[model samples]
Target: MIRMENVVKRYNELIALDHFSFAAKEGEIIGLLGPNGCGKTTAINCMLSLLTFDKGEIEIFGQQVHPNNNAVKSRIGIVPQELAIFDKLNVYENIDFYCGLYVTDRKKRKALVEEAIEFVDLGKYRKFVPKKLSGGLKRRLNIACGIAHKPALLFMDEPTVAVDAQSRNFILEGIRKMKAQGTTIIYTTHYLEEAEQLCDRMVIMDSGRNIASGTVHELQNTISTQERIEVGFITEDQTIEAQLEELPHVVKVTKRNGNYLIHFEKQENNLPDLIKFMESRGMSYTELSSERSTLSDIFLELTGKELRD
Candidate 1:
């Protein structure tokens, strides 16, 4: 439903988007994962035709996107990271007002507003103002306002940030419902776990370029580390740590909080090898667990450990 080829956007000496290209299929959620200042927002703005790019093409629904293309713009919705609803407007009123932007007919707009309220499970609070609602409820209202028109393509930017777990789950479940009903979403978030849970495919970005793109399993296969073993000892010892580094298939060993985390490249017998090493040294562990690689590991491995501003 969307495509970008060699998209480039620059701000003076710094290039926010460097030959960045991305695409999303219909009825699937594509998680645009990246840290701050990695060009995710810039790419979205350019795709929406809200910002001009230096080169490349962006097409939505197989047609070039333009700011004046109301025919195309009207079919897209955006739920920004920051709340965008009016504080003074009641839930129903806010949704009605935004829906009015796309749906001019008063009767149709009224129906859409009510449906949106139910869709986000905010029907009981229809008359409540934004200021009176909790953070999560406010987030839901923001989503309701953006999606009241029921656009086919939706852009959700960190919709779960800073909310309680209950509210987060509610919003995530609501999003899944939207997808099941055939809405294609482009979701952006720094929360790797959320991306893992929600996205069917992912595009990892760093330094304004795509480092990797694939399904969770496919991306995991591309990285060197395939397995991780976490073991903790009763006491820390440098000699034992060195022995672990020499274990079969062990690529990296890190110690944190009195636990030894061993990273291994794709190979067999990784766990047994670690056990043998510990036995040879006559060392005992308080905890031992084996697990496969995670999206967070892949993200840090590709983007580096340095903190982003």
Candidate 2:
């Protein structure tokens, strides 16, 4: 439904998007992930024609993206990271105003606005102005406004940021419902777990480039550490870490919270080999757990673990 190729955007002496390329199919949730200053927002702005790029092409719904392309703009919706509601407008009026941008017919727009209120569970606050609602409620109203017209493609940037757990879950479930109804959503968030749970595929960006793009399992397979086993032994020996390192396929071992976290390369017998080696030495353990590499691990491995501004 969307395609961008070798996009280049520069600002004075700095480059915001350097040969970045990405694509999204219909009815899929694509996660756009990156550290700060990585050009995620820049790329989105270029696609939305909010910002023009120096090079490359961006197409949405099989047509070139432009600011004045009302046909394309009418079929798209944007829920930005910040709340876009007016403080003076009530919930129903806020949603109605945004929906009216695309839906001109008063009767159809009114029904769509009511549906949006119920979809976001904002019926109770339909008459409440932005100042009277809580943070989570305000977020719900923001979502309702953007989605009231039922656009085919939606760009949701950190829709759940700083909201309570209940509201977050509600928003996520509502997103799933949108997907079920054939809406393609481009999702962005700082919460890795949320992206892992919600996105069908992800595109990781760094230094204004598309570093990696794939499903979660595909990304996991690209990293070196395939599995991690955390073990806490009741009997402590000074050489226990070194001894465990001798096991087959062992990459490295690090201490984490009074436990030894053993990193291992891909192997089917990692756990069983460790268990047999411990049995031979008569070593007993207090706690033992095994898990595959997670999205956080993949992210850190791809992007250096240094702080980003």
Candidate 3:
């Protein structure tokens, strides 16, 4: 439903996007992962024609995207990283105003506005203004405004930021419902767990380029690091930690919370073999848990563990 071919954007001398190419298929929630100055937002803005690109082509629904494509744009919904709402307007009014952009008839527009409010579970505060709502409620209001028109394509940039856990779940669930209804989505998020839980496929971006793109498992396998096994034995043996460090494929071993946490590298998960070895060595564990590499793990591994400016 959306495509960018060899797109490039520059701010005077600094390049934001350089020969970047990406696509979002219908009914797919593709996570756009990256750090600051990585050109994620620049890439999205170019696709939407919100910012001009220096090179390459952008198309949505098979039509070239330009600044004044009203017919094409009306079919898109955008919930930006920042809140976009009128403080003076009540919750219902904010939704109505955005919905009015697409639906001209007051009768149809009113129904869509009501549905948007219900979609985000904001019916209780329909008449209340922005100042009276809590952080979560404001986030919900921001969502209702963008999606009231029932667009075919949605762009959600950090939509769950700063909301309560309950509200975050509600918003995430709503995204699933939209995907079920066959709307294409381009989701950008800092929360890796949410991306792991929701995205059908993902793209890990950095340095203004497409560094990685694939399914969760596909991306995880790209890293040499695999399963992390933490073994907690009923009997505390100081020798156990030293013995585990001697095991094959063991790269790092650390003790925490009265347990041995072992990290393995370049090994097809040998947790079962480790268990057998521990049994033969008389090291019995009361609790054993293995955690597979998550998007966060891959992210830090690929992007480095430094704070983004």
Per-residue lDDT of model 1, residues 1-309, tens digit only: 999989889999899999998999999999998887788888888989989999999999999998899899889998987899998899999999889888999998888898999988998899999989999899999999889999999999889888889989998998999899899999988888899999999999888898899999999988889998899988877787788887778888887677888989975788787788788888988999888888887887777754231
Better of 1 and 2 by lDDT: 2
What does candidate 3's lDDT look like per residue over 121-225, in tens digits?
Answer: 988899999999999999999998989999999998888889999999999999999999888899987677888899999888877788788999999888867
- lDDT of candidates 1 onward, in order: 0.88, 0.91, 0.86
**Going through the candidates in order, what is the number of backbone clashes in each?**
0, 0, 0
Candidate 3: C-alpha RMSD after superposition: 2.9
Ten-residue region with minimum lDDT total, candidate 2: 300-309
Model 2 CA deviation exceeding 4 Å by range: 306-309
> Per-residue lDDT for 1-309 in model 2, tens only?
999999999998799999999999999999998777788788888999999999999999989988998889999999988899998899999999999999999999999999999999988889999999989999999999889999999999889888999999999999999999999999987678888899999998878988889999999989899999999999779999989998888889999999999999884788888889999988898888999988888888888653221
Cα RMSD (angstroms) for every candidate in the order listed = 2.4, 1.8, 2.9
Candidate 3 stretches with Cα past 4 Å from truth are: 232-259, 265-269, 283-287, 306-309
Runs in model 1 with CA error above 4 Å? 234-238, 267-269, 276-283, 306-309
